[model samples]
Target: MALCDIGLIGLGTMGSALSLNIAEKGFDIAVWNRRTKVTHAFKAEAGELADKIIATETYEELIAALKSPRAIILMVPAGGPVDDQIAQLRPLLDPEDMIIDAGNANFHNTRTRAASGEPFIGIGVSGGEDGARHGPSIMGGGPKESWDSVAHILEAISAKYEGQPCATWMGPDGAGHFVKAVHNGIEYADMQMIAEVYGIMRDGMGMDAAAIGGVFEAWNKGPLQSYLIEISGEVAKAIDPKTGGAMLDAIVDAAGQKGTGRWTAIEAQHLAAPVPAIEAAVAARNLSSRRDARALGEELFGAAPKHLPHETLSIDTLEQALIAGKILCYAQGFVMLSAASEEFQWSLPLPAIAEVWREGCIIRSAMLNDMSEALTEDPERNLMFAPYFSDHLKKNHGALRQVVAQAALHGLAAPALLSGLSYFDTMRTARGTANMIQGQRDFFGRHSFVHIDGSEGQHGPWAD
Candidate 1:
């Protein structure tokens, strides 16, 4: 048997799609799965592509099939499974051999695993099943030399935006997954803001799903155009076959999460990064999960008072508000990324990151292209302070403020949107109320407050 260029373990949907994609790129692949049946099934499914894929029933066989300085990609579950696979493979591999974890493992864990004297790359692979089969955005982080060894294969299989592959070596030790977590965090905020807008249309304006779907469809063609927005329109328009009603109405209200967004929020808190929009989105998902509590609250308080009448709300205003909120959410995510880069000494390529996100990922949007350009122009400043986005917020902030106020008055839960508006408002404020917080902290906890004139820390004597 001819030696394969790379070996892949795990035959899950993502794993299979990625393997097929790699093979289609003309690289011979050796594949193994925990279950022999799965490996065989995948080989059968490969059809004509099977010639390029070597299915191995054992780890030793898989290892033997790969060439010297072997590259093996693991598509197992995050956490224990990833560690388990690495442990199993380490004993059979040489120092120069590489192990790439392509799942959504936490970045800290990636760092720990890499520090174990193993040549490992924790890569972030985004875009869903279809994207895995065709092309997906890839962000890799490990030793620069290790990354270079497999860079050609990764770049070849990644999605392209105007001939530039949506793949890049982010930074050493877990930067890729860290960026991926922030990506998901921004995704949470994006989806939540879209849902909030749909809520306003459905409840505040008394519009049906079809009408709201049309609104989202229109938004998809404008500044708000994105995969999430486009999907929201499709989801809203879906009809239930059994009930002949809107599919969204038939679906459950509860939202499910896989922890990346939560991780992003926790990391933001640890880094002292203000990511209220992402936090609010994660909180909203948690709130949604407590359906029983919500029901009880509704019974206790009676129905929420509806203040924003259907005739009073404007669809145009809602669109503008969503655009502003999205901008704020992206700003928060990018700011968090900047903080993480500084804290970790990663020197993350923010412009390249934005460029990678412009094509294949869930967050892909025209705005990302603009973001790439903005960051390229001023790599040091926060995204909110970028000239293009600052002007964007300046133009659309009124709509955001109005929408937030309307949601509050009407008893709607638009937490993400509200947080976005607040984040934007706070960022632009030269004199915030932090001094009061500092004073209270100093009085209660002896955490001294610094003066504005670069003076020494001072404490007040409070009279009881």
Candidate 2:
């Protein structure tokens, strides 16, 4: 029997799809699952691609089936399961054989694993099951040699934007996962901003699911066009089979998360990076999960959300506002990435990050294509300041301000939008209220303050 080109353990949803993707790309793959039946079932269901798959019942067989100096991808859950798999595989494999952890791992864990002197690499894979089976953006981080060893296969199977594959080496150690975390953070903000717009349509405009879906469908053709917006339209337009009503209407309002967004917010705080849009998105999701609290609060406060006056806002204005919010959210995410790049010494490629995101990922959008060019011109500058994006903001932020203000007036909770507007406002202000904060801190904690006139650490007069 020919040795498999690569091996994948944990034949879960992503694993099964990715294995098929590998096999479909003409690479032989050895696969294993904890349960013997799952492994066989995957091979059995693989159709013609089953010819390229070697299903193994045991770790020994899984390891033996791969070529010498083998690389195996672990699709297990992040944290302990990944560590457990690595520990088990370490003894069975040679020092040169690499283990690739491909789950939504915490970057810190990836860093620790890479530093353990083992042949390990961590890659962040984005896109859901369908993308896994066809193509998904792949962000790789580890020793350059480890990434180089597998780059061909990764690029071969990854999603592409205008023929450029969306798989590339991020940097050493946990850079891939760090970029992925930021990707997810932006995804959170993107989704929240969309939801907020949807809420305005649903509650404020008195539009039903179909009408709201129509609005999203129209927006999909414009600057806001993206996977999330297109899918939102599809979701809104879908009809319930069990009931005659809209499928989206039947769904619960609460959203579920897998902790990646929360991780992004936590990591941003650690880096002293201001990602308020992402932070607000995470907070909104947390708040949404508290259905009972929200309901009780609604009852106590007498249901603050009411239908807006007919002339209050337009779908066109909402689209422009969403455009502005998206720019701000992505700007904050890139700044956070820049901060993390410095703190981690990774020298991450900001333009490549945007390039990869232009296709496969949830946040993929036409806007990112412009962003790639803008960042290539100057990666150090904040994205909002980039001429292309700055031009867009100048055209759109008025609509954003109006939407945020109206949302507030109507008692709508547009946290992510509000945060973006606040961040944008703060960024444009050269001298602000922070001097008052500095004085207060000096008065209470003697932290001292610096004056604009080239003075260093001076005590406040309040100390007397």
Candidate 3:
């Protein structure tokens, strides 16, 4: 039997697509799955590419099929499954053999697993099902030396932005996964902001799904052009065949998450980074899930007020607000990434990360091209402080403020947008109301407040 260049464990949708893509690139691949039937099915469906694939029945067979200094990519579920697979593969593999975990596992776990004896690579793969079959953005994090072993294969299967591959070696021990988590967090905020804008168009302007979809289509041609906006437009226009109503209207309002967004929020809190927009998005999802509470609240406190007249809303203003909200969301995510980089001593290359996200991923946008350039120009500065984006915020924040104010007055739920506006406003303020909060804390709990001149241990007197 011919030796395979790489071995892959898992024949799920993502794994199968990725293996086909790699096989098409002319690399011999050995594949294994927990269920033997899955491997058989994959080989049967491989068609002309079957010649490049070797389907193995056991872990030992999978390891034995690979070439010297073997490499295996694991596409299992995150957390415990990843560790279990590592334990099983450890004794079968040599010290130089490499194992890459390509799931959405927590970065901390990746770090811990890498510290073990195995030559582990923690990679974050994005771009969903279609992208996996064609091209995905690949972020690899592990020992720098291990990257060279699989870099060519990764670059071959990754998406390209302006002829450049959307794959890069990020940093050692979890940096890739950390960045991927932040990407998902920003995705959550982006989705929530879009939903909020759609709500405004639906309720405030009294537009139907088709009309709202037209707005999203128009936005996709401009600065806000992105995968999310494009899909939102498609989703808005989809009609339910049974009910003959908008598909979105027929579906449940509740959104589901698989923990990446929550992980990002928790990490932000630990790092002291203000990710209000991301947190608000997560909270909004939780709130959406509490249907009984919402219904009860409506009965007790009365339903939300009727939307304002259509004349009160402007599509241009809505677009501006969305752009601003997206900026805030990305800013917060990047801030968390920066904090994590410092805490972990990863020295993450921010520009390269942004560059890889330019295409293939769910958050792929034209804005990332601008971000990549901005970071390249000033590597140390936060994105909001960049001249291009600062100027954009200066011009667009008014629209965000106006939209947020209108939403409040109309009793519309725009939590993510409102949080974005608030975060931007707070960041720009020189002297915030936090001093009063400090004073209150000092008076009640003797927590101590800092003086204006930088003196510490100052307490405020309380009136009993």
Candidate 4:
């Protein structure tokens, strides 16, 4: 008897990789793709394994192959296409059938999709194709009862990082994708910061890519070690056959991003959360990818700032600089999430979220150990106020400043990471320019402002 537990729609890179992971875990899979040829090809590739994988070109056939009130995941591009597919599937699917939107769909859309009176899960699957094939970070948001129904299959497909499956039912409504979206936003900023480090090392310090990679590898052994740093070291060492040197030189400087990263920044802005790094990350990608940015700048301002060489940085100095930037990256990601959780009423658990990412997510860092310890002691403690982290940030602010200064000296952009660090520092301080900004808000909008003086200031008039 063909025993299929999960039905996968769309076998593109993500879908195909995830299918492999699920099937390898001893679960039957029913597969379908809009392009029948692709489905046929996947069927051919499955061979004897194909027996377990029932392939169908039609949604009805795919639904027919599933177990009663079946569980299905849609890996299609989110937006109108997802809605169209869901509309088609709704009639065929029973009321109790479960549908997981496993793509990078906006949580807003996830919320809307979930309102259909059926169990709809908005899942944020991070780690890309490799993560799907191996283990990736998974964030699910929906009814708890629905998660109870389908979580076993989710756990099987998720990669274990730090002894826990990198999968969590984040919260209600759109919380899962919201977390995932923000995770990608953080990822964008994190990648840019690492790339800037590479630029500084290669261009400013007169080091080769391999040399930079070597330093990154060394750093990975210490408190700064992370998946990003680990990958950075390998990327730096990757040489071009033609140049017999770093392939980074041959690769285009432009970075492409799906809308999730940009969407995160926009949502941050909407919620009045200061997600400078994520915003900077998105803007940096846009700037880097635009060949005409300089032309546009020249058109507007007549001349763009010329790129300058950075102050010479010793290996030790560069490492210190990296330490600061890396710390700032994690700090910003968490801060944004914390602020968002508050805005959305998700009441997300930070330490658990950090723990899940320890092995699987791209931003997993050695600093997570500190964060995890902090969270474990006080799971509800807002991390910004955590004493140990506060001390670490206070002690390290100088290094972060130095990194930002050095990047600026080279006329390079390090906005997101640097801004995030700045925000973290501003928030941690009991008194700072940020307080002044808050005070002004109260003066203007009649919003109450808390003073360090333990007195509430009356609103409604500035002259008073």
TM per candidate comes to: 0.97, 0.99, 0.97, 0.89
Model 4 Cα lDDT, one tens digit per residue, 1-464: 47589899999999998887888777889999999999989878975666668888899899888998789999999898799888899888888898889999988898888877688888888887888988888888999888878888888778785467878888887888988887888788778777777776665567777788898899889766788888888888898999886887789878888898899889888887667777888898898888677678768875423333444455565566556555565666676777778887888877777876765666766777788788778865555567877666666667667767766765656676577667666665675676677767887776777656677764535736
Q: Could you give candidate 1's per-residue lDDT for residues 1-464 as a string of tens digits?
A: 58999999988989999999999999999999999999999999898899999999999999999999999999999999998998899999988899999999999999999898778999999998888889999999999998999999999999999999999999999999999999999999999999989888877777899988999899899999899999999999999998999999998889999999999999999999999999999999999999999999999997664647645668888988988999889988888989999999999999999999988899998799989888899877888788898888888889999988988988878999999888887887899999999889988988887888777777768613
lDDT, candidate 3, 296-400, per-residue tens = 999998877457776786899999999999988998888888888899999999999999999889999989999999989987787988988998898899999
Residue pairs in clash, model 3? none
Please give the distance, in angstroms, between residue 375's alpha carbon in candidate 4 and its true position after superposition. Answer: 2.3
Better candidate by lDDT, 2 or 4: 2
Better of 1 and 2 by lDDT: 2
True lDDT of residue 291, candidate 4: 68
How many residue pairs clash in each candidate at the backbone level?
0, 0, 0, 2
Best by TM-score: 2
Candidate 3: segments with Cα more than 4 A from true spot = 461-464
